[model samples]
Target chain A: MPYEKTLEELAARRAAALAMGSPKRLAERREAGILNARERLALLFDPGSFEEAGLLAQSVRPEMAGRTPADGVVSGFGRIDGRLAGANAADFTTYGSSSAETHGKKQGFVRAACEKNGLPLVYLNECAGGRIPDIMGAAGIGRAGEGGRYTRRRSSPVLAAVLGLTYGGGAFACINADLVVMRKGSVLAVSSQMTTSVAIGEEADPQDLGGWRLHSETTGFVDAVVDTDAEAIAWIKRALSYLPDHANAATPVQADHADGDAAALLDLVPETRAKTYDIRKAIAAIADAGSVLAIKDRFAKAAVTAFARIKGRAVGIVATNPMFKGGALDPDACDKIASFIVLCDSFNLPLVFLADTPGFLVGLESERRRLPGKIMNFMAALELASVPKIALVLRKSFGQAYLNMGAGRSDTTAAWAGAEISFMDPAVAVNIVYAVKREDDPARFEDLAKEVAKGTSAYDLAAPFMAHAVIDPRETRDYLARHLDIFSRRLTGAIGDHRLADWPPAF
Target chain B: MKRTTIASEITGKVWKIEAAAGSKLAEDDPIVILESMKMEIPVSAPIDCTVVEILVAEGDTVAEGQAVAVIEG
Candidate 1:
């Protein structure tokens, strides 16, 4: 009676649009151990919560008609753990999900929607670079430039999961994300090996070009690596649990229901300073139980960076792993800590520093790797970060690493009873000053070391106002929890301008 | 046979050789130990192999990434 025929026609078109690329292509994707675009969205979002946008969008040009379904992407709003989130998943089954004018526009649309709604954006990137014919000539070039440009100004978090052979625009989305999770076998690169080889006249395998190991260990682009898409999605959900929904919003507090004895930390650190112990044990004892999520753990062995909660409040932790290089900061460690700091600062997360370092790594290899440049860069990041930082000298905080770890940069700083805060190790300092090694003059070296050690003890520094307090090891949990409660207010509103909110992740 | 070099990750003195030359080892077995920053760090074989050679003697200084031993699988 009232345009019923028209309504039926619209319904028929929608059904056809949702069918995606083809049954054969979809089956091939499944056989390859990859999830279909729709399935990926289903896994990422809460059940029945997704409200798709641009579902009926097809190719704008007549030549590309009937080929691009949803313009090669599936974008929508959904809830992740009941918190609103946005996603744009590339439909690898459709024209290899390569970016054309429409694809880029759709991506831009979803990104803008996420920004406007203050929802976290997740990109399920799996594509074969840019579409060839659709992106040729004047009009096409203008549209390409107009879309898929990442400015990094969003207040809400942007995360990416590289699930397949992601290149070109896919690579951009993954690399530019605030944090990225990559599937174990997937590769993310600026261009295909074939294209790169043709352009540069050098050939290499795809895995060697942009494999998970390279991104995770060398470029530091990937924050986590998992064996499956489901695992990656689960990780993304868990990561979001630590962040506020948006910049103006307060950080979410869930009943993580921390259940562990804080006093366990008293014995976590070894009584003898020379012995190596797992810093994770000390961290677990002090942080909210079961809330620690370590990032890049295998890459930078010396610098241990993780996200954990203290009394249901989120905080970024940068600690030294005495088990590796005696907690010395190397080139990899510097990059790791610097990126972690930027991430924490971007999301308005407070920083907690647990420092015990001999010094920056030194030698021919270190110099060859530009250790000084990396250290200076890390120091610059530490100094520029305006987040509320709480520092604790667990045992040995020596040399330039002492200041770089926020001993002097933090809002609240403390030291353990046995912690030593000095320019260098007492023995090393004596040798440098007196031009004598332990083998040369043991007695004089011992005397000079003792004299220098007297001035560098935690008590001496606390007495002279160099440190705020010299507390018992067991008091660490209570002190940090209380400080976090006081500083939690800094995570909301304009208190923190989020100076690093738009910082690029490539560095 | 594949030969893998075990390198020291820190600039330090060779504290000890955990496995003698020609000894058999499984994956992740410590071949040599280096002492730096008053900490003992073991340079371990990445895979099951037999110790082919020990390059540095105990008390000898080795730079970071310096080859400390070689293992053959």
Candidate 2:
């Protein structure tokens, strides 16, 4: 009872900070079925595990001091799936959870702490952008940019979720995150519609400006689109399960799960080169059942980038989806796969490249998109990746795409008996090398095409040791599982060199 | 009834028309098989619907994002 009055004052301050915002605003959020910042943090971390940081902090501006709770941001460290991680959730109930000087410092503290501790960082972003007037001019804007918020070294995995209208800083975090799960109704953009309309003198719908669909389908920014906040958090947790807490840490491993029927791969992938099939089916057959988590799934339809477990160990799978563009590696697909390689390599997850590409896409439009440079970037990332890589040629691996898909670059390379490794498609080669059209001289073209295809078979590549082994289609899963185990044994502690750790998260 | 225009996802010549006009189709049912990059790429119905029109015939070239069929759900 000696310091009762001081204790009372302390409790009063804590209560005020904990209250978050006016009751009416909190009630409005509840009515709208949107979780508040604190609630989101609760859902993100384990039960009673979150240790709040800067809980007593408020706005630095005198006028905004009493109104802002936790300075419009809640940041702390907690166990996500029993691994320590730092998280910052923007409190939309207060000032629309806008990024201001004080909150920016708090978020920076969490980020720095995560980096120092070598822990993953998560940003539950729903900010309204830089706080008006607070970050309007030179002094304020300079303070906002102080901690290198936009510069991501990727020392640790950074995950973000866009659960509501997210602009400027929020959008930047989402874009830079290694994994981003966006809620369906949320909008993520550099500026909100009001600012865009005023600046451009044209009205715009928020959804049209930066909807989940736009990011998922066009920009390739978001990894997954979910319907609810819980689903988004679930996705983040699931993705994090596949990654190490930090770049130097050993990749996480789980108990061996049932392997998908490898024999089904033979049925899923067509032996006939002209018959296109969904590569995902083959992927599912090759990976452990129910362990494939696709990244940028909706963006680059021609490429499939996913994290899957092969015999209980995490692996990154990059496959060509023949269903789109005849499994050609276009500029977008190249970027997608390259970014994925950077992620898997940085996190020490071994990579599995399922090659079935006809090569890079051609034509004026593809060139205009700078396909050559993108192809090189893809190859560079693949070459720079220090993680154990295993390549499996299911059908066709042609031209530079074969290298891009880890043919010679992988630690172990295998091809199905029917796999074709070629500088170009045999049919196309016949036209170019022999100057014979299929329609003009069907019989002669067939003979020449068959002649051109002679040295492109899996046996042809194997005879010279270009392919380490020629496998049966039914042995695809077993081949990868065994090779992954073999390659893993070479690693001192299942950790990679992480050569691509500093690669930009978004291309 | 909601009308939808099914678009070809790639530039290719129509190799085969699997669904005819007025044919009832289920989701993912291939309406036309396009030949591109020496592979048969199927342009399928996005939803369970009835084909109202076929915009391209077999061997006709179609550009990417080109509307190739009309359907009503």
Best by TM-score: 2
User: Which residue pairs in model 2 clash with each other?
Assistant: none
Interface RMSD of each: 1.5, 1.2
Residues A354-421, candidate 2, lDDT per residue (tens digit)?
98988888877788899999999998999998899998888888998898899988998999998888
Q: Candidate 2, which segments miss by more than 4 Å at Cα?
A: none
Go through the candidates in order and give each one's C-alpha lDDT.
Answer: 0.84, 0.89
Candidate 1 chain A has its poorest 10 consecutive residues by lDDT at A487-496
Q: What is the DockQ of candidate 1?
A: 0.57
Which parts of model 1 are misplaced by more than 4 Å?
A1-4, A490-495, B1-3, B22-29, B45-53, B71-73
TM-score of chain A of each: 0.95, 0.98
- Docking quality class, candidate 2: medium
